[model samples]
Target: QVTLLQTVVGAHDLFDVTVQLQPGGGIFQTFVRGSGDDFSVVVPDVTRVNKYGRSADCTSNNEIRPLCYCKSNLMPTSSPSSASKSTK
Candidate 1:
């Protein structure tokens, strides 16, 4: 089973993320700009439920599950290294 080890919310128009895992040895990174009121969660290594961000839309009946929601409106950067650290 995969476990959610941590969550880091973005700030200052920057949503740079880096996730490190052990035993599973997984590493994921993604960057999202804070413009347009967008939010996203990215898990780089695998293409499972744990990799994508979920929305808070209650109408879809998906909100009851922790991983069901809207797709991010923000654009992803070409590289995680180019992402700026949020100041908040």
Candidate 2:
């Protein structure tokens, strides 16, 4: 199971976010709602890239799930010699 860092939300428990992929590839903007135990929005799961983002506004009923943005690895740089320390 995933372990949360344990945080408290204000009376309105939701936050908006805008994530940019490595090398400024693309931006992922969304407002995840709820504690992530059980929350969802309209999405197609039969295929890949199956996830939805926030609704038109905060008052909308269709709220996406809450998730903590993180980084597990580094993206490649334009430099051919750009290298990272081995994780092994």
Candidate 3:
């Protein structure tokens, strides 16, 4: 099953979306924009690395790094309020 992961609307009404296939699937990233009255995939489907447990696989050179959600990002972070509530 293919799931729509993320969608970003850019200038000129362009839609940048990332779709992920279920069951050990790769990330398919593409861009869509309006063609007259109908919308279409303007760009080709680019398969990005599965950065689930291996965020290290994505480097600075990777153009899709900005669009990826690293597993580390899902980790809970200490909120400002929690950090401020320290023992006296």
Give the TM-score of each candidate: 0.25, 0.26, 0.37
Q: Comparing candidate 1 with candidate 3, which one achieves the higher lDDT? A: 3
Cα-based RMSD of candidate 1: 20.6
The per-model lDDT (C-alpha) reads 0.42, 0.34, 0.60
Per-residue lDDT of candidate 2, residues 1-88 (tens digit): 1112222357255544445443223345444455658643223221112233331223334333222122322433454444333432
What does each candidate score in C-alpha RMSD? Answer: 20.6, 13.9, 11.3
lDDT of 2 at 78: 53
Residue range 28-75, candidate 1, lDDT tens digits: 455544456675544333322343333334345643433333333233
TM-score, structure 2 vs. true = 0.26
Q: State which candidate has the highest lDDT.
A: 3
State the lDDT at 7 in candidate 1. Answer: 35
What's the CA error at residue 75 for candidate 1, in Å?
39
| Candidate 2 Cα misplacement greater than 4 A, ranges | 1-11, 36-88
lDDT, residue 9, model 1? 57
Ranked by TM-score, top first: 3, 2, 1
Cα displacement (angstroms), candidate 1, residue 64, comes to 27
